[model samples]
Target: MALFWFLHLYLSQFKWITALLQKHSEIRMRGIDLPDDLIVEVLSLLPVKSLLQLKCVNKSWNSLISDPKFVKLHLQLSTPNRNLALVQYDRPDCRVLTFPLNHLLHNPSTTIPTHQFICKDNIQFQVIGSCHGLICLLRKSYTSDHTNIHFRFWNPATRVISKELGSFQQSNYHAHDRHRYIFGYDNFTGSYKVVLMCSGKVKIFNIGDNIWTEISSFPRFDHDVSLGSDRVNNGVYLNGTVNWIAFQDDLSCSTYSWMQRDTTLEQYMIILLDLGTETYKQLQPPRGDGVNLVVPRFEPTIAVLMDCLCFSHYVKRTHFIIWKMTKFGFEQSWTQFLKISFQNLQVDNNFSDWNQYQTFMFPLCLSENGETLILASSLPGLCQVILYNLRRNRVERTKDLGRIWSFAKDYVESLASIR
Candidate 1:
């Protein structure tokens, strides 16, 4: 009862009188003194919003919550609860949103408003990637195309925004818009890093040192295999590693020289970067024929589902497929976990034929508990999001995002702040 009242009053509203009322004989708040360890443990388990509120509770609370040790420990204790996110990267309303998973699972019909972290009206920003709780934003420069792209790290929890102003800059980057950047956590060093890479150049920015170092080493290029250059790809950060969807040139059997004639299969692979080693490795994903993996909707989005790296593919705007990597670094372990058919989208949405027009859909994410997937499909000027229940194997709550949502991506909140 005391704890409940303490929290209710603590969160509902706290006044200076509330502090003065704690004038007990021992200078305690009605004998409600909590040890430093206890406070750390409790605060670590709380949500980021409540934790942010408690930072202003007192000097001691502020000091404890802001400590780097507490931030790391809190993130460790608060796994999976890292919350889901949505992003709108359109011209006028560039925004990123987030909401708790429990709210969607328990009270989905209640229409909970998402937390809008950033919304710049006229400026354009790309959500390069998100890890722990920090998001990497690449702001397109309007001044000069020759200047390096400006990247910023923003932690909504800490409300600390910092830009990477190092000397590292890309030359003639407009030619390689496919170049990507990822922000990931280094567990061994207890630090954060920004990995910016194109076809040949790779740079790493250490958050602690606030400096960017060029990485000369790279995954061996398959020069023999003919692959297309223009393709859309996204990065997925998992377990101190960042995985990017890439192609390996061809599906020819490397061991048998005669098998090289089978150039029909465009072999797709995962370009993985281990943050600890700051090195790169190429891993082949599950093999599939017939569909060009580099096509618009088929370019698999690397994602982490149920604590495993997954290849999320939207099959030409009709089917959603999830290929799970059962064991790390093993290509044969890639197994097709789920396949949901959206063939009836035309009938359901009252269209004559779904495949007639320039179709589009992006797999937003798998739900926190790995129950359903949040899918967003572009329609004319508006957008729609639907939750596909994996267990039931059906779609529910066909949500119309009301015409403004241009893009969506999965994100989990964390205490990761930029120094």
Candidate 2:
């Protein structure tokens, strides 16, 4: 009876072990059924934060997420379609708002009012520019003793803020004032730089290293004749260099009594600051009536169209001309793309002051497949943003964001992946 009982117990134990083995094999087979490509596709769509968190799920997943090829593929898949929203801030107590890019693109007749958002009171930010789903912010602060300025690299979609770069400090020189012009990121350095122009001195601040380096090589023109006050017409980052148009005085016209030189013809020069060498060089504009062209109003009037830089010029009281850079280099060709007269649009009133709204308006940065120009107009009580399709030659009114200080576009693709 004891032998029989031992046999029974041994058989039962063997069967139980076999069942457990079978279950483990089934689970392994199920995991193998999932294709590698499918896993990659699904994982690529998840935000970077989620991907980073999932690294601990398994060894395969960790390796995949860290793969350089996967990162590139994820970024390509997540590129945001270029569409911009112009939010308004009217009431002192109003909140920040966000609008959809599709609504602005498809519905020409649809006009949605600006909605409010949280955290407007605590953060004072202005959109300097956008690139690769990242928006550069100029954060300003006011206290009792001294003023503080910082450049914040932010991702609007993910709400990720990089470490703030405090006031740039360097030996032998100080920033002219706190009201310095902070340009967006230079692609070469993958960092933001500021141009400090005050008291006849110009300096640059590299936000990545928090270093204030002096730009002593820039040609100095008399402060009186230079376009110092014309913030919009001053310095613009194009192709790699900061381009500034200034008027140089002919010193020969000095009367000796006041030491004032006679005004010469207005010259627009392209100042290229090589990121590698940290130096500035002047490039002359293409020969022709280039110097004869009047400076466009100092507003956010310049935009990147295709591979060229474009801007609108008030040709006459009733006409506007669009100019485009045709070739690269300082002496490259600049051709007129469009000569638009008010009569061409059949508009009765003259748009003489159209540039006034340019400062408050933000461009809807569109991808190659998106619309050409997106702009917002801020009126006294009511504000409207308009999107212009260059390919279709159509203009449509977008949502009516109430009074807003500044606005930007947060691309959906920008949130995908942890980077």
Candidate 3:
């Protein structure tokens, strides 16, 4: 009787323990039931590529990740100031490709292999500018009576393309046409606006409303003065304004009018177009002796660093002076950001050939914390991307890739969807 009682008690205790463990296992498999907000906060720290892969875990996760609000939040929380190179190679064929910055920064042996994203576009175009993860691409067909210059808004990350957003029915596609466009988002209106700039004609198009309205006309230049096309200037979108280096045409008489001179007589200025008020203003370039140098090739490049307008001007071969604005629209706030010398670099055989091609270096991307600047050189032959460690005061060169000048832009991967 005693043995039977003992055996029965042992069996009951074992069964109860097993049942408790089974319940615990079920909780573990289902997860701890974290709060939705907390889950999103944690998930937002992940890269978009990983987030897309995690969507298949369950329905709840899929819905959470697919939410537009979540995507915007994720974009806000994403790691900024990272290096992602958008390479547009014009050789063999015109192609837009992307690669990790470290591929060009670190030693080949120590470099982590990053997948190169070769974007496939159905139409022939060139990237004009990128904002809020939406890249603006320009495609021109001059066969028609009016110049059919179309803009394509593409979110390379989400693979969403907004085709035929707008077009400029230009009178004629002049090789020396100064027509350009800037795509920017207006915080006040909560809409994306494209600023169309020509020699004298200026217009603004609101993407959300799908309407184009003529704004104030650009400051006119004398007929004798030469007006430059978009290729001759650098266009930057910042603070709901489009900023570009506008040049005053040189009208001085020369013996050889058509001759290509090593030195130019043009003066560069910053042209600002406010998206909110539809106004135009010009900011003085950073006051310096180097800023006065005539640019034989396009040299006055504009960029945005942490809500401040930054300008880069080259004095001579590979020597550039960087200026930053501490206060927006304040000329007094302009300060020398950094002085970089690429002339001392250990150039390879291609470097000479690059110089002959009138190659120039421009800022491609800046690292998080703004410590490093990755620059690409436009060269006809293989040229390495140059990485400058601003903090360490060090200059490093990568292996020879295609001419650093291959069509490339600073690209950021995001989940921004464009319908």
Score each candidate by Cα lDDT: 0.59, 0.49, 0.61
lDDT of 2: 0.49
User: How many clashing pairs per prediction, in order?
Assistant: 4, 13, 4
TM-score of each: 0.75, 0.65, 0.75
What is the Cα-based lDDT of residue 213 in candidate 2? 81
Best by lDDT: 3
- Per-residue CA lDDT of model 3 for 149-177, tens digit only, reads 77777776656788687776677546455
lDDT of 2 by residue, 240-342 (tens): 5555533342331222322222222234344556554567665554332645644333221444556565544443335545556777553456776655554
Displacement of the residue 25 alpha carbon in candidate 2, Å: 15
TM-score of 3: 0.75
User: Candidate 3 has which clashing residue pairs, if any?
Assistant: 81-368, 88-407, 377-405, 378-405
State candidate 1's TM-score.
Answer: 0.75
Error (Å) of candidate 2 at residue 17 is 38
RMSD of 1: 6.4
Error of 1 at 32 (Å): 8.4
